[model samples]
Target: MTSPTISQIGEISLIDDIRKQFSQKLRDVTVGIGDDAAVIKPREKYLLLTTDMMVEGVHFDLRFITAYQLGFKLISVNVSDIYAMGGIPRHVLLTIALHKNTPAEFVHMLMNGVKDAMTLYHAVLVGGDLSSTQDGISLSATLIGYAGKYILRSGAHVGDRIYVTGSLGDSACGLHVLKKMKRTVSLNKKNARGSMHSFCKKLGAMHGGPARSGLSWKIVEPLVRRHLMPEARNPQKFIRDATAMIDISDGLLIDLTRLCNEGSTGAKIYEEKIPVSIEMKKAAECLGIDPLTLALTGGEDYELLFTARQGKRVSATCIGEITESQRVIVNASGKERPLSVGGYRHFQ
Candidate 1:
């Protein structure tokens, strides 16, 4: 007989499996999964909770990223969710599944990365589980946080101005650089060692790095790290002054669409106003792709995009303004173009 999939097993049966695996329930959880809802006691009235997952090959490539960096990035992304709401991240529960043959050292290194992130953000790992997978590694992280006051994405009004933290598109360009580097490394495997080294030196010197007859690791390292490791934005201004806000996880345009959807509004952003980093500029020039295009549609930025009333600003560039009409548009050189919905989508 063919083996049954999750649909065949059914939701209740899957819940039973979960209950069996984690039978030791916490004292605070008065009710379990069987009831209408799971209950827990909280010291504070306001609660913030969010979960994020990362999968090998699909979400990340192990060849370019280390276990520690991977762990750090995963937790940092979750923390960004809380920070976007102007909350303080406090607790995390992590679930990790990896191949059975994976080394204990690798696991330890990954946990060490997690610990580093928790310490950095003052978050504690309350609970977790481990499982064996047939192929690559997968991780699920649930982060809980709180705020005395928090911001929502449904409060933006027509007069509000849109702002973005730091620059955009660095991470996408970094991914591009890494892919090029990967291709170069693969091609080097087929070439003579000396010629490969010479070619690498020439490529490195193409930028303004020192021509020491060696590869320039400096020029490309920033972009690569931007992809492998990114920072979460947690600013008080987002909560205190902004009408609505969101973190840039799914490209600028898509996330902006979400924000507009929440508020039942639209927006118009300037092409030159969207910030692109220097490294991204150089890399995009080399790749012959418009840097602004990368900034608009490339996701995983983790920066805050918020709408605040103009002149109520807290050190941010006014990229655009919320519109009463229900369509997002981008303006450039006295011309206007309808914004495309082409961005990172998990299912589509």
Candidate 2:
């Protein structure tokens, strides 16, 4: 039987369902849903606030993502901002607008994704609003966090070493693979195990019944997963030593430029030191693209880019160091050139 749509359920029912889904009592929250405003207990630590929006046909394409993945990614994106400041996420507020024709099942899946992500971050859903739209979906989230000592993008100084929490370009390469496959992969734990069979079979069929361009599911899976459901990297391990920080949401060069501009300093990075995964390398080769270009310009990786004082012990990959007045990249052959300030900009 076909499921009902949101219009049939009414707005009040929809709000009630969401409220019940996240009705947990937390010590930090005195009032949650059903209230005019949420009451959060004050904390001694510094409070961090951040918000992000995802619009249909602009920020995302439903054809490439499931409602569950969409919900999870929205939360993760905002949480990354808090983490970039070296803060711990504690509370969340969401605003979602969907067409009246949107299926009830889609709403259920979306809330499931949101709930699971909140649980993962140990955060509570204090409150939010819901509304019906005319055509497509629009989602926004506000994340509140706390930290004893917060890091900023303007804190880097000359002689500080630049570090990245993990490998880059995986998410961008994954996006390329998805565009070729023209399909969505369900990443829920219950269905993730068997998702590969369908992902490979369909993609193979598109390219004459074999993995496309000699790329197997093992290699493609991580790339696509990185794009669909990226996890926010925690900075707790090295937060104390970090002098400056930002998350690579818009691409390495653009975000790095923001950090440099904030501190009024220049940066020099080594191409050999930039971390690129083996999966991305092979996939990029098969797709006839340059891996380094992807690593440098591909955005939405959600990895942390930070700076720390030189000679300090840091566990992350040290890619380069801060310079006095020039931003350049050193090639393997020792060629020096200006760093390109290119990334995902809103208006061209």
For all predictions, the C-alpha RMSD in Å is: 8.5, 2.7
Q: Give model 2's clash tally.
A: 0
- lDDT (0 to 1) per candidate: 0.73, 0.87
Q: List the residue pairs that clash in candidate 2.
A: none
lDDT score of residue 163 within candidate 2: 95
Candidate 2 residue lDDT tens string, 251-293: 8888899999999999999999999999898778777778898
Return the TM-score for candidate 1, rounded to 2 decimals: 0.78
My TM-score estimates for the predictions, one after another, are: 0.78, 0.93
Instruction: List candidate 1 stretches off by more than 4 Å.
Output: 1-43, 183-216, 237-239, 326-328, 343-348
Best by TM-score: 2
Cα displacement (Å) at residue 137, model 2: 0.8
TM for candidate 2 is: 0.93
Candidate 1 Cα RMSD (Å): 8.5
